[model samples]
Target chain A: MKTARRNKLKMNAFAWMLLFPSLIFLILFTFYPVAGALKTSFYMADLSTPQPIYIGLDNYKGMMEDDVFWKVFTNNIWFAVGTVPTSILLALLMAVFANKIVRAKGLVRTAFFYPTLIPMIAIGNIWLFIYTPGYGMLSRFLANFGVGDINWLGTQSLVMIAMIIMVVWKEAGYFMLFYLAGLQNISQEMYESAEVDGVPKWKVFWRITFPLLMPTTLFVSIIALTNSFKLVDHLWIMTKGGPDNASNLLLYYVYEMAFKFWDQGMASALTTVMIALLLLIAAIQFFGLDRKIHYR
Target chain B: MTKKISYTLMYAMAIIWLIPLVWTFWTAFRPKKLALSPSITFDFTLANFSHVWQGAPFSTYYLNTLLVVVGIFTVQFLTATMAAFAFARIDFWGKQLVFVLFLAQIMIPADILIFPNYTTLRDLSLLDTKLGIMMPYLASAFGVFLLRQMFKTLPYELDEAARMEGCSLWQILWKIYVPLSRPAYISFGVVSVSYHWNNFLWPLIVTNSVENRLLTVGLAIFAQSFETGAQWSEVTAATIIVIIPLIIAYMLFQRQFMNSFIHSGIK
Candidate 1:
């Protein structure tokens, strides 16, 4: 009995020894920064205040009044709204298409998914040329059909549309992989029985496939949501949140404030907001959306 | 039939998807003067690729990116393995709470905490180093969690079987759990390697010098071709240079890559 107790103690100590490195790194990088960001948000840490003066609620107040913040926030919302469902729907469609056709399966899947493998910066560089007006690919192609040249990336009203189209192109394939997996998980017997019932292809998809794909959709939605928030790398290449902040995202704004403007307080404030929003999304996924994503 | 229409639609969409890539390849290979020209031409040259290659330190960027990706993933595998072994088999206090806390990394990914993490690296005097670019991601919660799940699914009798031969915990983990968890390792490995390979913002923010820059950031910086006259050829060449390795790898190992993504996602 004493030996068994001693063995347990030995195992306990061994476990801590194993976990020590991970614990230290997790603290320094993840937990500490999150806590540090929250604390820094309350101070006045810009150039005017050389010492990072403590000022409660002032930073938040300033953020509320910052027109740039609201503009970017609105842009971000519109970005999410524009990208999520469209990409999800397109992904589902592509997955079904890829699943159905064997002759062109590999080629079709590669065409859809190859873009997902390319880094966003490269995608930005490629699409920037594609969206350029006058002699650009999209414009020149449209000119073939009697359309006037439009600056896709330079114009304010049209930039969001351009970005959404590019993102859908970039991301739908990634989500399609998940939907394809979901489709495969549906038993062959289910499809065979559906065919025996004389159900149309679209009707079978609507009634059977779509509902069965809810769990995958929910999973893909979380990835897409977080991506919408974090995918500002392309903005650095294409717009820099430009044409007068029309394309600025929260994270990019945070970058401009912290690195460009050296406004640590505002940067921290924005970081805190991003962290909170992410947590809210995480909370919703875990608490709220989990209940709704029913599997067949 | 609906099936025929869907198949045709699929082919059309596939072609639409291929255009940007085709455009890039066409612009890349064609003579520089005809890059944005409104006429069809078959004249091709490799000058743009050679020009872009000479203009940028792509070799250094590739080296730096490869070093950090490998370095980060190597360290992650080590840390995740040890941590996962402990969480899965060893008796430890606050295991559940600690595991939950580790998940904070996932919720607030390193990409989102760019500023704070930059400051953290600066404080460590790690900025501008490959290690700096790698430091924030060395211990991945996702890896640990995935591996822990994999380890748990392993039969307990294997551990007992090894232990009966006077094997240490290391022996049990090495001989039993590690070998059995190859699929999970491969899944997490592909996910981790690809993520770090394509990661931009943190690396961009941390590493400033040419020697320290990764391919994505280097490509972005080298894109000054835009201000010059219709240098889209050179820029697209540079873009292709950065992406071709991954594209080629994908072409070679398509099934393995796709299955890794699918397995990782479902887990």
Candidate 2:
């Protein structure tokens, strides 16, 4: 009995010893910072000042009242709404067709997925050239249709659309792989049966394939949603969230508030809200979809 | 007939999707005088590459990016392996709670935590260092979770058999656990390396100097130097230089890269 207790104690010690390295880092970078950010969100922190003035909900109030924050928040939602569905649909289309193609499959798949592997900054730069007026590839292409040169990135009305198009192009191939995996996992027997019943291809897809790919869709949606919030890297290169903040996104706005504007309190407040949204979606992804995924 | 149509459509879409990249390559090689021409210029020149090289210290940016990504991956591998072993093999008090908390970290985007992390780094006097850029990512919940899942699938008998020979817990992990989980390590390593290589925003925030800038941040800044209204060829060349290594690596390890991404999704 004593040996059992001692053995348990020893095991516990070993567990802790192994856990310490990761735990220390998690605490330093994640848990501690999150807690600190939460705390700072309630206070007015001036970098020049030695002490932070505790403002108690003022930052939250400021965020609610700030029109730019609302604009950025709504712009992020629009970006997500604009990008996620189209990208997923394009991915599914690619995956379905690519799955059917036997010859040159590797070449086709590589062409689809290659953009995902490149750095977004590089892609953004490439797109910046595409959007450049009066000789840009996109402008020249449009000119061939007798359309006048369109200021793709510079115009307030079109910046977000331009950004969305670039993101969708960059992202669709990535999500296609997930759809491809999900498609491959689906039993061929189901498709065979659907065909035997004289079902049309669209019906086979809509009834059999789409329903089966639900989990992948959910997972990809969660990822794409979070990515919409997290992926402001392109904005730094392309628009700087501008033509009057039309392309401003939540994460970039938080960045602008903190680093560019030097408003840590506001940034923390914004971050707190962003974290809540991410956590909400993550919860939905993990817990909401965990039981529903058909692993076969 | 339907299959033929589908194939034709897929190929057309693929080419269309590839146009930006193809155009980047096209623009990068075009003679400076024909950089903006609608038609492809057959007058390919290395001048754009030379101009790009002269325009920025891209070599330094490459080195800095390599250091930061390697630093993050090395520490992440060690920490994740250790933590994953603990979770997989050891049953102790609060293990579940600790793991849940750790997993919760995965949900909080690192960018959202930037301000506080920046403050923490500043207080530690680690700001402006490559280590600072690497610090927040050193402990990856996804890596820990992935390794733990892989470790759990290994037979307990292997560990017990090693233990019977008087092998310590550490030795058992190093010998049996680590060796068996090579596929997991590779997949995780690919994901981590690609992610850190392409990561821009955090590195942009953390590193202030030209010397400390990673390739992504450097490319952004370089592209923004709008001295010439249409230095498209030079800008594309710089962009290509930043991305070409990854492109080459992906081409070499095409199957492995795709497999890693697919396997990462399985988690």
Model 2, CA-based lDDT: 0.87
Q: How displaced is residue B101 in candidate 2, in Å?
A: 1.2
Candidate 1, residue A235: lDDT: 92
Poorest 10 consecutive residues of model 2 chain B by lDDT?
B35-44
> Each candidate: RMSD to true structure?
1.9, 1.9
lDDT of 2 at A280: 87
CAPRI quality band, candidate 2: medium
lDDT of 1 at A169: 98
- TM-score of each candidate's B chain against the true B chain: 0.95, 0.96
Measured against the true structure, the TM-scores of the candidates, in listed sequence, are 0.97, 0.96
**Candidate 1 lDDT by residue in tens digits, A160-250:** 9999999999999999999989998898888899999999877887889889889899999998999999999899999999999988889
Cα lDDT tens digits, model 2, B1-267, are 987887898899888887888888888888888877666448879999998898899889999999988899999999999999998998999997898878778788576788889999999999889988988888888998889889989998998899899999999999889999998999999999989999888888888899899998988888888763567888888988988888999999988888888877777
